[model samples]
Structures are given as C-alpha cells and as structure tokens.
Target: MMKVFDEYRALSDDTLKPDQPKAKRFIEAMRKFLDKKENWTFWLPYILTLELCVKCGTCGEACPVYTASGRKEIYHPVYRSEMLRRIWKRYFTLSGKIFRGLAGAKDVTEDDINALAEAVWRCTVCRRCAMVCPLAIDNGLITREIRKIFDAIGIAPDELKENGTRAQIQYGNATKTPTEAFKDTLEFIKEDIEDMKGVSVEIPVDKKGVDYLVINNAGDYIAFMETVMGIVEIMNYVNADWTLNTPDTGVNDVVNYGLFYSDAELVAVAKAQLETIRKLKPKVVVIGECGHAYDSFILYKKLYKEMYGEEMPFKLTHIVALIDRWIREGKLKVDKNKNPEPVTFHDSCKWGRCAGVYEEPRRVLKAVCKDFREMYPNREMNYCCGGGSGFAIMFKDEFLKFRMETYGRIKAEQIKATGASVVATMCANCKGQFREIIKYFNLPVRYAGVSELVANALVYK
Candidate 1:
C-alpha cells in the first residue's frame, strides 16, 4: 500500500516551511480570500459541484498515470481531490463544525500543500477522465485548478515554475534555445533539403503576404529536423506560399504546463503567437508538428478575442491537415514504393484526442506508407504515451520507462504484430517519445512524422 503512494508520498519531504515569509504571506492571502468570498460563491460552489461526484472511479480508470502506474491510490483521480476536499471543509465549511469526521474535514498543514502539489503536477490534464465520467465532472480541470492554487502559493514544482518563467521571460520557450540556434537549425534544414531532393529549398522567415505563416518549436529543428526539412520539401514541391517567423517562430509554449493552471500567463503567451501571425497577416496559420501549440491556437482563440476585442482573422491548421490537403489537392506526390515496409501510426494525445485531428494524419500515412497498420485501440480512445503532458521534458527518466512499459509497450507490440518496419506520427513530441522508447527497448523500428515519410517517398520533378 505504501509503495502505491511512493511516487506521490516522496513529495512530502519538500513540504513548505511555515517560517518562510513568502509561504506565510501566500497562505494568509488564500485564507483571507476564501473567507471573503460568500461561502456559497466560490468555495461552496466548487465543493457542491464536486460533491455530486459519485466517485464511480471512472476517471481513475481513464487517467494514463493511473493506468500506467497500476491503479495506485496516489494516481487515482479522486484521491487528490478528496484530500483537498477535506482541507477545504476543515477551514471553510459549516458542516465541518458539527460533524467534522462525517464531512471528512482535516487541517491543511504545509505537508498537505506539498503532497497536493506533487499529486496535481503528476497529472497531464489530458481530460481523458472527463470522457469516462458519467457526470462530465472534468477531474482534469479540477486538477488544473489545484495546480493553480499551488502556483499562487509559490509552491509549484521547481521544474514547472522554472520552465514556465523561462518560457515567458527568457528565450520565449521553456527550453530557452537561443535565436541563433534556431536560425542555424533552419540553415541546416535547407542544406538537408538540397542534399535529399537535389533542389535548394528556401524556407522564408517573417515574409509578409505568404499564404501561410508557420510556427514551429525549436524541438522541430533540433530533434526532428527531418520533419522540418520535410515540410520545406513538400512546400517547395507544391509551390505553396509560406514563411516561417524566425523572430517569433517558437509558438510551442503550450508545454509550459503553467498554462494548464495560469490563465493570465496562458493568455500572454497565446497573444505572443497571435501577434506574430498578425504581423504576417497570412491566409492561414499552420501550426507545425506540435499538438499543444494547436490547442492554444484553436481552444484559446476566443479567449484572445475577449482580451484583445477582435477575433484573429487567420485559420489555424495543424501541419498534418495541411499535408493531407496537399495530398488531396495533388500538390505533393508520394511514391509508396519508397517505403515498401509495413508501418503503424501513434495518435498524439493532444492532436488526436483533444483536438480531433485523427483522420488527416492517418490519411497522410496511408498515402506515404505501403502498409499501414492500426493499433488495438485507435483514434480518440488510444492511450497516452505517458510523456504526452510535458513529461517528455520534465520527468524524462521516469516517463521514458513508464511509456515503454505502458503506452509504448502497447504500440511496440502492435507494430511487432504487424511486422512493420517503421512507426510514423505527426506530432513532434510523439516522435521523440516513440523514438526514445524504440531505442531503449531495441525495437527494430524507425519512427518519423507522416510528412517526413512522405517527403522521403516524394517523386520530385
């Protein structure tokens, strides 16, 4: 039983010290804010809304962490919420007065804060639990709000806080890759495109009047340069008018993880992307092979409008959708003979499930690969890679093992059963996660984006 909470329990040792001035100030502010709110306004509303939660454990069953971690209590959806519920009641609820035990009220110590921070950060907020919940309670959203409270109290996980601040303040990305590195990467991709296709392909930077404004993260350049080169090759082959924003090209700030909790910072970073797109005024904004970036563009567009008082004029399209459209429009030509071996696709959690971009990438894969195989559970129902929610960067070590044993295990088994030589996906994060897992397990399979495979198979004029 104790081992079940091992990952979660270890966090308590870093509990906030009561003597810290910042901790004391933040805690006092929270207590006073909760008290000022009409008991029914925010506090009771949240409690009453959450109390209807039947604890059917549907969410527990849906969480990737719970599934991968073997149904541990610490990974359970209700566990953290239940713990917070007790603390809320002990401090604020009147029912906690006469029947404290019945209401499950408990005082929130510094240890409680630390434990809750760890528990909440562990979740990816993928919202898979909401799909399984009969009441649509959205435990993922609750987890995010819990994270918000932690952020307010200055007790967020060190990695999350540091990365979030770096994203906002430093190089405008969590990884903080230098602008010089970004431009050098572009130059490298151009050289690769020339070498592969026998043509010098130009990927324009910050060019106005281009039909599409493409924003990609530095990850695309460093780890998945093939995909970046692929996009350029396809664009050149198709004669599509597009430009990359070198100055503000990194819109992949969605992994900041803070956005899942902090609305203000989320809006600020989202506005930065929009501002870049607005400067170009392209017909469409093509989000490169990153999923969460598209989430920010598609999901938070309205939020941006509310803040800025006008809707963005550009259309947000994922790169997969763009590639699929190119294939359909007869712009990019693929010769399946180049990739004669069998291949399977891994659906990205954000792109496939959250953003409903399942079919476009599959269509692109079907065109690129001679044989395309499906996993046991396909589309929206597919399991997470355990690294989907920024775990690829944050808890790389633990997430690598977890992904191989769980999501990657399933994917590898499916690929082996199909006798596929490669696994292809559209999302950059998926590419990294799958590639690492395949390497660690010594699986004889190469992983790439659908665009990269298509680019490799392209029949150039």
Candidate 2:
C-alpha cells in the first residue's frame, strides 16, 4: 500500500481524506485499464506520445507551472508522463523485459504510484504543451490518463468526485442545491434582477418546447449571480424563448467534472443532463459562462453516439457566441460608456483553445467596454488562468498555496502587464481563479465575467 503525499490527500475543507489505493490495487487497475480494447482508441495517442517524445525541452518552456516554479524538475510538462512511460516499459514492453533498469526503465513501486499520483494534480491539463509540441504530442491527455487510473482505483481528489459529480448527480447540482432551494434561488435571482437592474425578467423553468435550453454551472447561482442575471436580461431583451431545467427535471448544472479524470463519470453526468434536456424539448441548448461545461458537451456528443447509436438531438451553442451574434445583428443595443474603464480578457483553456471560442468573447468585450486591452498572447495561444481541470475548487491548504504562488503566478503577471483595471473572463473557473490570484497577489484588478460587462453596458430604453 502507498500513502499519497500529504498535500494531495487533504480535503478542501480540511476535515477528511478518502482511502488511498494499495500498490496491488494500483497494478491491477493499470493492467485492466491497458488491456481494455474499448479504451485503446482513446489512449493510443498517449502511448504514441510516450514513444514520440525526444526530450527537446520545448514543452517545458511552454508550461506555466514549470516556468512559474522556477523550472522545478518535478513540475516539468512531461515529468509525470515520463514516469508513466517508464512504468509501461518495465511492465509491458519487450525492451524493458530484456534490459530492466538498464536504459531508464524503473520497476513500478508504491513510491512511483505515490509520486505519480501527486505529480498529476499539479497540472491544469491546459494542453499548451501540445500546441507547442513539434510532434503534436499532448502531455495534457497523458496526464488525464494517469489521473483516470487513480480515480478508478478510488484515489482521486474528493472535490472532483464525492463532493462534486456525485453531489451534482444526487441533488441536481455540484453544490447540493435541493429542489426547493433551486426554485427559491431562481425566485431570488428574478427579484434581484428586477430590483438591481430594474428588469422584470421571468426566469422560465421546465417550460416545454422552448427555442433554447439554457444551462450554467450551479455555482453561478450562489457565487456569480450577475452572470445568471446577465443571461436572463439578455434572453428577455431579445424576447427569445428559453427555459432552465427545474430541480424536479433532474438537471441543475452543466458542470461535468468527469472530464477531468473519469470517462464513466463523464458519461453518467451527461446522461443525467441529457435526461432533462430530452424532457424539456428545446430547439437548441446554450451553455452559459462555463468552460468545462462547453468542452464536456462536445466530448459527450461523441460518447452519446457511441453509447446510444444516435446523434444528440439538440444543436449546441455557447452564450458568448450568442451574445456576439445578438450584438452584430443589433438585437441588443449597447453603450460602451457604461463601462468606461480599462479591461482585458483571460481566456479559459477549454472554451478558447479546445472549443475554438476565441473571437466571440473578444467581440462582446469590444462591444461593451471603452478600453479593451489585449493580454499579449490572446486567443488560442493564451495561457491558462491556472485553474483548469477543477483545481480552482480544490482548496486544500497546501494545494491552495501552490495554486496561488506557482500555477497562477504567470497569469497574475499577464494581468499586471495589461494594466487593466478589470479582467473579464467568460468561464466561471477562470473568474474564480482570477479572483483568488488577484487577492492572493494583491493585484489592482477586479474580475468580471464577459456577460456581467455586457449587462452593465446594455442600452435599456
């Protein structure tokens, strides 16, 4: 048996830790995982990446964590992937069988499992390394594979599993918002929007045959009410038909934390969300202000076809893209004077790079802000807010420290260089991370969602 490093084991609330897997269990899990032919198509590139890496060190330079941590060897982009490669060589490769420990092949041990488990979480899995890779290898995909193994063996982060996806599955949201509470939250938001923005917007719930089925991260209702308000205001302004799934409908959040580690969890959550979507019967589904939610649905489309032998019924679109089109088509008039301050955007990895949603948010920002500054490397090549892959919510004390000081340091520097008073991001995770890092580093910047900025600038006549 192997105990995880102290930092990796601590829960976000500091109250409890889940059981760690033993060495024998880890070996069995890996053996079963590698042998499964169903997973080969998914994992083949990871195996190829292992064989293809040439130690060119270009990926290391592109890694924010490695560069921010002063190039720590352990935090290298390929550091953990290299460990998996060695393990594969020792246990499954012919060369390793013939020349064990002779050419960088090390036998798998409890320490390796322990060390590898610890190393995997340090990454945001932003795939910036893959973008810069000469051979198109993705260290991020390899990292997720390693994480999937530990997650299957019951050794994954508690925030991502028990308290996250499980809670979402049970209560219709990751925050454990019950049926009554979700209804009450909608009521409160509707009233708050009327009071604050003077807009009497009806938040439609479980309304059948709507043109759009709008979904958001459940956390937004609690922590980012403005984002939800913005969506409501915009939807109402355009007089578009949309409905939110009530808790009784068995869908509350768009978050699929399963995308971080486990495919089974991904499919399970998607299945649950899809159950609600099918009930509501909308023409299209809109994802609101969440990056992983947007990316996971794209993953789910493929999985849905494979599992059910048909295409996902509804067309998918992002809120930013919708807002941009609304502005271009003059459906919503906006006055930039309402937001007369310097602003910059922090692109969420999954939304911007993975989903190719770069230009829409920028167009919305330019439409709503007086002074919009560009972070040096904007769009697809942008750096992560360092909170990708669910690390923003993993609030363990040591992990928190590493996130603020190391992982998020480069982002803070970028924000500072932009000299923007507010950094507007579309994704909830990026907003949360920027909020923390701004406070942690004491930077003179406020975090705002693109929707919030748009709401502020909406020309109400």
Candidate 3:
C-alpha cells in the first residue's frame, strides 16, 4: 500500500473498489490505451520507457511533488510510473503470462485500477523526472497515458474535462463567455487602459489581414486582464498590426486542456483552432502567457499534418519572444527605472523546459526591471509551480490544500530565497498557483505576468 503523505487528503477514489462490470470496462480501457497508435505521438519512445526504465529512483529526487512532500514515497515519480509499468507487463508482456509473480506482474482488479487512477492525478506531469532519468524515460508520458485511459472511462476531474477541454471545444473558450460578453470584456479592458494611461486605443477584434493574431487563455479576460492590457500596450507601442479573434471565429482562447490528458481531445481542440486560423489568414499566431497554450501551439504543426495531410497553415510563436524582439529592435521604449521593486522570474515548466524558451523571458525581464533576481536552479531545472497539467484550475478543498501545503511548498521556498517583492512568470497557471502559495505560505510577495511588468515599464516617447 502506498502511504498517503501526512496531513494531505487522499483523493476521493483512493479507496474505491469498482464493481465487476466497471472493473471490466477499466481493464478494457487500459488495454486499448496501451495499444492504440492514434493515442500517442511518440509511440516508440513510450515503449522504450515501459521496457527500459531501471527503477533507479533518480527521478524522485528531481520531482517537486516528492521533494515538497518531504520525500513522500507515494508522490515519487517512479512510484506512479511503476504502477503503470506493472499493469502493462501483467496484461501485455509474454514473460509475465508465464511467470507472473516472478516477473513483478499481478492480476488486474478494480482495486488496482482505482489506485492507478488516483496515482496519475497526484502528479502534475512536469516532466522533470525525464530530465534526470539516465535512460531519458518520460514518466510524465506514462501519467498522461493513464489519464487518457481514465478519461476514456469517464474517470477524470470535471474541472479539466467538463469545464476545461469540453467547454473550450464547444463554447470557443473554457469560461463559456458569450460572444457579446467577450466583446464587452474587451471594451472594458480598453476603457481601463484609457483610465490608467489616458490613451484611447481601439483593440482590434476579428480584423482580417493583420500581421498577428494574438490568442490568450480566455481566463485572462476574467482574472488577469491587466496582463492582457500589457500585451496590448506593447503591441500598440510597437505599431504592430494585431487582432484578437472574436468568439465567432471559434478560436477565441489559447487554452488547450487536452495537452494535459487525452490526445483525442487535444487533436479535437487543435483542429478547431486550426480551422479558425485558416479562416483568419494571419501572418503569425501569438500565444499569450499560458504554459499549456504554448505547449499546444508547439504541437500545431504536427497535429495539422496529422489532420489535414498538409503543412500547418499559420506561424505560431509565444508572446514573450515578441516582447524580447521588440525591446531589442528598439521598437518599444522601456525605462527599467519604472519598475524598482525586487523581481524574480519563475520559469514555468512547459514554457521554459518543454518549449526551450529559457532566455527570452529572462532577457525581457532584465530589459524592463532594474532589480531582477534569479531563482536558484533557474531555467530548465526550475521547480514546477504545483500547477502544471491543469491542476491550477482544479479546486477541490482538500486537493487545494495539498497543492499549496505539500506540492507548492518547495516553490514557495524558492521564491522566498530570491527575496523578491514581485514574482514574474510568463505562464498564467504559475501566477494562479503563486496566488495560493503567497496566502498559504504567508510570504510577502506578489506575482505578475512578465508582460504586465513590461507594460508598466513601457515609456511613451
């Protein structure tokens, strides 16, 4: 029995034992998830991980959840990966059929399936384990594969499945904001910009033939409009032609929750966004400060090929890269003295590690802030914000407590060590996680998107 870490609430399904019929369905689902080629992008790599992982336990040392939970065995990356590996060997491998116990294989049961579902969610799928594994096995891939199986069997969190991917696919945004309401929100942001800076800027929406079509996570309009304003400010200052897609275009939001779970849903959302992009005909599609959105756009080229049997029609890039270019090209004037507070950058896992966007945001920060500090083990090695893989939006009270008190503790300590008054990160999820961490840990620090700081430091000359 894997012990639950002290004080953290066990997941609701931790003790569940599915009835016979449900158990049969789960076993069938797992088998299909394992064998389906459509379900995976890197099928050979996954097989390599399943067959080659040596159980060295080096991955656990690099896992933030394991380290933050005081090295809880349950939260270890290999602990979760081992469960899936054992199940795979039990059902699919030749030697396991003959030498079950000796081969470390066991009979699949409702109890086992339930436990597997519970184990997969406990991880944030940051892929830090892959970074440390000597064999370069991606434990995050296993976790996501299990999640894909669970989602097929209707065993996923509603926050991610129902409100996240489902809502995004059906409603053009996860929030399900009406088209008119989205327009009203943009108008409100425009008014706020005028009020703050005494400038009247017309935000281009649904405009055709623009050089850039910028898509942010729809949630930013609700929770982080200031960050949206920041991007808009810089775009205007640089005289760059850009437009935000209206909901009518069916690609209003940058969020793609499928990146966290089902490849089917991932492709579904990507296809919808691609159709919209095809219609818009923008020179570039800019993903705003959401890590998964950045990750999703990165997959567009391959996904587009898989779907259309043709090349991706539009170019995609993250907003931070554009900000860095603008600053370096002298397109936007910035006064670093405008931001005097001690600031530190929290490298989001997908944006920095997975996307290989390490130096761009750091360079942008240095150009905009006078007292920028670096977190130890920064860039690709930086710890997760306890909010990757769509956990930031999940809000079960017990899980939230675990997210902050246990999973987020190590990141909180990292932030404290920087001694910065403001934490600058490019991912919205990281900012959301920091919101909880600041309150739970009672650290005297606030968080902002890097674009928000750049907007603050912009000098209109």
Order the candidates by lDDT, highest first.
2, 3, 1
Residue 127, model 2, lDDT: 89
Residue range with the least summed lDDT across 10 consecutive positions in model 1: 1-10
Using TM-score as the yardstick, the better of models 1 and 3 is 3
Query: Which candidate model has the greater lDDT, 1 or 3?
Result: 3
Model 1 lDDT at residue 233? 85
lDDT of 1: 0.68
Instruction: List TM-score per model, in order.
Output: 0.87, 0.95, 0.96
Model 2: per-residue Cα lDDT over 431-458, one tens digit each: 7888789989999989988888998899
Model 3, 1-461: lDDT tens digits are 33333333223332232343366676678777666475467577778888898888899889888887788787888788778777777778888878887997778766667667777877888888888899999999888888887778776777777788889888899999979999999889888988998776878998876899999999999988889999888888887899998879887989888888888788888888888888888999999999889888888888788788998767888899999998999887899999999999998999978999999999999999999999988888888888888788877547788788666888888899999999998888888899899999999999999999999998975
Runs in model 3 lying further than 4 Å from the true structure: 1-21
